[model samples]
Target chain A: MDRSAIIEQLTEIMIDVFDLDDLEYRDDLSAADVEEWDSLSNIRFMVAVEKAFGFRLSNSEIESLDNVGEMVDLIQQKLA
Target chain B: MTDVLTLPWLLPAPADFRARVRALKSAETVKAADVTTLAAYGLDLSQLGSLGKIVDARREELRAEGRLRPVLLGVAATHTVDLVAEALPATALRHGLLVDTVQTDYGQLAQAVLDPSSSLAAAKPDFVLLALDAASLGLARPQFEAAAAHEAVQSALDYVASLRDGVRTNIGAGVVLHTLATPAESLFGSYDARVPGSVRWLIARFNQRLTEEVVGDSDLLLDVAALAETVGLARWHDPLRWHDAKIPCALDAVPLYADHVARLLASARGLARKCLVLDLDNTLWGGIIGDDGVDGIKLGQGSAKGEAHLAVQSLALDLRRRGVILAVCSKNEEAAALIPFREHDEMVLKEDHISVFVANWTDKATNLKAIAQALNIGTDALVFLDDNPAERERVRQELPEVAVPEVGDEPSDYVRLLSLAGYFEAVAFNDEDRKRADMYQANAQRASALQKVGNLDEYLASLDMECTIAPFDDLGRARIAQLINKSNQFNLTTRRYTEADVAAIQSDPNKFTMQVRLVDRFGDNGMISVVIFDRGLDSWHCDTWLMSCRVLGRRVEEAVLDHVAAAAKAAGATRLTGEYIPTPKNVLVEKHFEKLGFVQTCERDGGGTTWALELADYAAPALPMDIRTTIAFAA
Candidate 1:
């Protein structure tokens, strides 16, 4: 799947995770952007991302990724 | 396809039963209707969290209706419980909220369980849930010496014991301990599982110690690791989740965790199921037994379906060994139905493993009721398993009290489905449990013999029954504690005591504890009765007097009282006081004092009639047969 397609799926998962219908997702968005997004919830969020995009990220790799854009970049590298 | 929301499959059980099933399958948000239905089974943690908002609303609604019973739960976790907090509340709400827990902070479990003046002590919880992991307990790492590992295990156990004593002394809420989930991705690899000082070996050793500890201590133990194994270790413990949230278990396993804890609480509340009623044909074997003769039945290792049937049989046998009565209810000719068990070479289940087997062309609902009648257990205590959907559905519709988990088309998933039902969640396993099937089988044999003998008293004498009454010993403690918790129908005063409570009562100079073991020509009944009497100056008060329902009408109760009166007289007590406590289940014991010829004494304020018997004037209850007695250990 292309980056845009992956992002669309990721956005849907993000919406489901936060339990908000109108919750929007952007590449530049980070944990600060979402209200319920915290360290505790990041595991669930990253798990959803891995499922949506089909790639695994280490704990350190997840900690390193600062924003959704960076996650998309990482996904691109892994998928490629 | 029709809308799943229509819930056409819900039938008579609940209007939204399908919704709960759907919730487990796909996260469509947990509805209020889903709450009661979901409580019946487990869900993955992710599925549970999906319904958080609905659970929150449901909680408030429950509180408004005054249904939520407040339980102060002292929680100490190795992880951040943001997800557990979200998941467990809904699970609790669904299971009728025996404990509407007000939990303490994370990382404060030691303080909650140990210190009297801890914030948790101030909360004054009804129970304490200590989710201690091996890492936090300092036993996860590979030790240099096996002795060092042994020391750590001993220290952890001692620490827990001290905490329990502290809680009893200070907070008064009993502790509930969890067996550590063997950390996925072992440090020592294969060596961990084999080497004595390795992490896996030490962890296993620690679990053994915990088992021993729970048998001695009063606190309940939850085997999260065993539950984790059933859920699959990879699925149960997610490393990423652990690393990020400090959550030891996988987020998806929250429902299972909650479910197991809920069942334990239910067992503590005396709601555990007693019997498993199985079906033949596809349930017990791979195909129809009538169509496929004994020689042709698919029950051997050649086929996957056959192996699955064998697995179910293995599990059923295991349950029977754990005091869960096994019975068969099948809609086929008796000969054809039993042919697999009797003659089939590959069948793991034999006719002897089952306490009750009814095989005929009768409808299963009727057969199940008959089975319960023969076994002297309530229909509610029975769990019916059948491979046929129609049979399962019919049982569910007719006997709404009976648990009917659908055995799907896939044979591989058979045992998994049954295990998830949690019908036989064990609080304690003792020698009695292992020999329960044999005892019941002997009861059946006695019932059959009772028909042949003309004289009732003569028949009793023919059995050559001998009972040995002795003071409670350490070897009999677990079974004694179990009987106190489980023996309900014949129980007077219905006093439920844990192992620790039983120990205290046994050791107290002011109280007397004695247990009776019966051995007839058939077999040993194995510690069938317990009596705890409170010794007074001139009068002895009977606090707990109970006999197993299996031994009813065998004149054991009469023998017990006669022995107790003799003992009381020898101890220079003139009067023996007994109370008749009325419960919904114990009506058989209501007129017990009257039958035993005890004089009418002052009735206790606790809704029970108190009666007294003068020891010197009391005559030994006459028996047609010669009585044998051994009272070696005095209380």
Candidate 2:
């Protein structure tokens, strides 16, 4: 529910959806940094996150998120 | 056969599912068998997508290794079909098909069908799916005037008919059309049905008209509106996702949608399950029939629990009425199992309804195999429904091909779970389908009588069978097509044909077609055999020879061969040629031509053999049945 916890959970989701060995969480890490993080997998990642956090990201919210930091910040805001 | 892998009935959470996927990925070499086993479990949308990627990769590898040939499915949709396409292969695995999909560009369905150079045309798929939704087809637009709404419906249907004709004439591929799922939100709420211009009313009318058009045709229809109604329409249509990504339905419901499509495709391939093998005790009735006597069993209309058990019986009876064969497999004493079916007043399934009943102290896996053998169907065609998880797990472990739904403890949930599994999905229904269960029951009766007679000759003679052999006509065309697709065992060539194909054959001047029906003192076995022969100057080639296995060991083949040889000889043919094509299910007829006195003439690659019988020296075999024919043939 906290920022660090949200970051950790988001990292796990990305690792699974992207089929990565491990991910180094950074403020600017985005789809451009991963080959497998395409549009389809991005949708999968959003679905997984919503199922995990028990909150839905609006269509616009899902489209506008820029990076890992932005997604973590959005989760923090939704939780608040 | 390899060992059956145990899997969970319920789908796991995302984390656990990912863990399992990771383990599969870490294997030294991913096997298609392992992937198929994993796919047998219930999967959600995310898991379906993930597993579909694995299936696609494995499909390529298998194709490259010369071990797999997939059915090419061409998809054309007005919305984004990427997710549905991705989930299709995984869902298709459950129905015994390796599907490789080629999708047309978004909103290019018309162009793809019209243009010869499009990728969809180039793919030359076995089946083309026109996945149109209400919004994409303009059916979602409401018109205040009834004339405008009717015109809109007419135009939409006309456009679809054009596409269907184009697909058939240009690509020569089967077309799969879908009904539009009407929008959930209505403008006038409960009064929407009163307004012919309302979106709901217009779409419903369109769906009814669509069903009327496609019902007797050779093409397949996926009832998307009915599917949406099954799961709440509100859950089926995701407006947010549709507006954002053009997703046709909710992402979570994609697996279910793909499953329905897969089942329809499987039915066309003659792979739909035919029998429902149910357990006694907790499955059919509430209390253990053995421990609780016939009077103590909770069934019928007394208590809620009693009615719940009765509902299960009612469902089984209904399935039987629609031509699905029913069998009972239990571990209790045979007498105890029969008491409820015979003595209980509230029982919906009676002793006469079941074709094969096995009650012994054997393990369920072995008993299920026996049931399949007794019914003359493959183990894969059996759907085992039991209330005990342990028994379900054992059957899953032993006979992985048999469908075992993770039916929870509640008897009330059994019908819903089994219904949603779509194990008995059918594409066509005829009078023959309604009487199929009765025919199987008659076969069971003949089996019991054979045991009493003690001699094959005496048994055959005592039954006093009579058959009417005639040329294929319009009246028997539907049943002929159904038998051609449904008969896997005792089928010489295992060739599948649609009703349209059969109709074309019927009118061909150079071909001879026969539809054989047998009836004895027991019951009428309605059109049990279909044969087609190609006429030649000196030889008549048997293009297809298939008989229902329920009539096996009764010298039906011998009688048919006698009639065919006489008919061919009478028609100025000097010889008869037959071919045996081997398939996993058709081994029952591997030596068919040889047994019928045809000498092996040539051996083909891939275990196929050709045989020829000299009609100049053909001797009619002694047949038990009194055969009558519309065609003139020397007896």
List clash counts for every candidate, in order.
Answer: 2, 0
Clashing pairs in 1: B45-B252, B72-B125
TM-score of every prediction relative to native: 0.76, 0.93
lDDT of 2 by residue, B14-55 (tens): 446666676776566666566667778667665777777777
User: Residue B47 of model 2: what lDDT?
Assistant: 70
Error of 1 at B265 (Å): 4.9
Model 2 per-residue lDDT at B25: 65
> Candidate 2 regions off by >4 Å?
A19-25, B1-32, B60-70, B115-117, B632-635
Q: Which ten residues in a row have the lowest lDDT in candidate 2 chain B?
A: B1-10
TM-scores of the candidates, chain A only: 0.86, 0.95
Could you give candidate 2's per-residue lDDT for residues A1-80 as a string of tens digits?
Answer: 67888888888878767767689999899989999888877877887788888899998898788998999988889889
